[model samples]
Every structure is written in structure tokens, then in C-alpha cells.
Target: MANIPVIAIVDDDEAVRTSLASLVRSIGYEASTYESGIDFLNRQSEDPSCMIVDVQMPVMTGDELQARLVEAGRRFPIIFMTAFPTDAVRQRVLAAGAHCCLSKPTGGDEIIRCLEEAMAGHAAQ
Candidate 1:
């Protein structure tokens, strides 16, 4: 049997993690939730197909996590969500090769679309 693709959701907010996990599962992907970037790094048993990360996480911010992953040569597609969206932050992540950076309260449909796009791009790589 084929292995299902996993999508990791990393956020300090429990509610955000739960809701995003449900959405990811609903759209036919396995979902993993982590309360922080450090938690994810220490606990992830397998590399996820993609990551949905919050930019302003407490311990390890999304940018820091992205940097660490890149330094380790793990280029899993990343879709960042930030409560405080700014052009600078978005551009920085984009320049660092993030799939996209989304604003909080983002709709389920938009998240799905971004997920599909990110997965498609990763598949083509």
C-alpha cells in the first residue's frame, strides 16, 4: 500500500493546531501537530510532505525553523501563517523559498488551495 503524505502543523496555539489538523485530514492527508518548532524537530519521526507553520511562534519562529531546515538540507515545502502579516515578513519567507505566507483567520478553502499548490510544486521537483 502507498504511504499517505503527511502535513505537519506547527503552532503555539492549540486551537489553531487542532483546527488545521482536522482540515488537513478532511482533505485526505495525514496530519501531525506540534506546539512549537522545537517540539517538531525533536519529535518528528518522518519528514512531512509539507509544513504549515506560524510565523510568530514563541521559542523558534517560523523563519528560524525554515533556516534550520534549509541548513540541514531539508527543503520541505513550507506554508507560513502569521497573525501579524507584513510585507517584509512575507517577502522574506518567499525569498527564502517558502511556498507562501498566509495571514491568520485564513479560510479553509485558501489553505486547501495553497496546500494543493505547494504539493504540486514539490511533486514536480
Candidate 2:
């Protein structure tokens, strides 16, 4: 893979997707924005270096996407962001090997940190 990583931002809200993609791009990653998990699933080419997805979406939730990927025997680091944060959600995603669960209005530094952490872990393996 090339050193410059691809970071996918999946969210149903247009503004959220746009802002996050812009932030990712500003951080120097090749960014792709998707309106839903299913859209990403259908269109994703090579697996992204890191995935930033919203916890709640219209058709497909981020957790559902994670499950589907796992069912397909695929492993990748996911960073889930949500306006509503819960202990249960945190536990589940963490147990499933997600990179982090961040609350919305999350800082750009934090997002970048999580992406770097996710890629670092992947690289170690």
C-alpha cells in the first residue's frame, strides 16, 4: 500500500460528512465521504487505512457495518463518533477491536490521533 492513507468518513448527515471529509483532507489523508455504511460497503475499493463512521445513521448503523465486515472475515480499525454516547455502545465497539468511540463535536486533533493510532496498530500487525 502507498504511505498516504485513505480515510473514509461515513455519515448520513450531509454537513457532518462534508466537514469530516474536509478535516481528514486537511490532515493530509486521501478522504472519501459516504452517506451511509451500505454505500461505503458497495463502493469501497481497497480497504481504507482508517474508517470514521457515525454511530447512528438512517439505513445502516456503524455497528452494523462493523458486524458485516467481521462476518465477511475482514478486520479493520473503526473510529465511531456519535452525538449520543453510551457505555454499552462503547463496550461493544471496544470489544470488537474498534480504535475509539468519540462523541460528536470531537476535536480535529483527537480524530487525527485516532486515525494515526488505528493505522499504527494495523502497521504493527
Candidate 3:
């Protein structure tokens, strides 16, 4: 459907990216996945969507990518997904305007909830 929201998932891990794509599509939204932040940026579609990005990556960290996006005047919703979550990192991402920071091993329901909230513009500050 044209009205269905699109979600962009950027992660270096093949398994994570593929799994996320499947899960997102299973929940009714369209999902596009990238192997790296640079790949996503280079071939980003013109869609008003939320981003689910891994915090640590080789080419660019999620925070760095977010910073660049902001500096370039691009304001899309972002939800950071990290396995190595830390207090300082969480605070930094929140301060940088991430919709939310989801610690890895988070359940499917929680991920969907985050996506729904982000699409509705109701994600946590």
C-alpha cells in the first residue's frame, strides 16, 4: 500500500540486517536494509521513514552518521540499536535527538512498538 510506512535498517552484521528486514516486513511495514551507514546514505530512497541503526560499525558509527545527517539539515527519526549499550552512550544519543536507544536482545514486540511510536512521532525523547 502507498500509505504503508517504510523503515530503513542499517547494520554491518548480515544476520542482524536480514533478520530485521524480515521482522519489519512481517509486521506490515516495508523494510529496506543496508550493510553499512555509507551504503544507506549513498542509496537512500526518498521516503519519510524511521532509521534503525546499530551503534557500532566499521565505516561510521550510528552517532556519527546521525550527527552528519543533522549537520546536513536532514531530520528523520532515528532509533539506535546497540548490543553494547552504556549510560553515557544512551545519554549522548538522546541528547542528539534519537527517538530511542534500544538495547540488543530486545524482544520483537518492543522493536515493533518503537517503530510504531517513531512513525507516530511519539517515541521517547
Clashes of each: 0, 0, 0
For residues 11-67, write the lDDT of model 1, one tens digit per residue. 999999999999999989999999999999999867799999999988789999999
- Tens-digit lDDT string for candidate 2 (29-116): 8898999988998999678888999998887899999999888877778999999999999999888878899999888899888889
Better structure of 1 and 3 per TM-score: 1
Better of 1 and 3 by lDDT: 1
Clash pairs, candidate 1, are: none
lDDT rank order: 1, 2, 3
Instruction: State in Å the error of residue 36, model 2.
Output: 0.5
Please give the distance, in angstroms, between residue 66's alpha carbon in candidate 3 and its true position after superposition.
Answer: 0.4
Which residue pairs clash in candidate 2? none
In terms of lDDT, the best-performing candidate is 1
Give the candidate number with the greatest TM-score: 1
- The C-alpha local distance difference test score for the whole of candidate 1 amounts to 0.93
Minimum summed lDDT over a 10-residue window in model 2 is located at 68-77
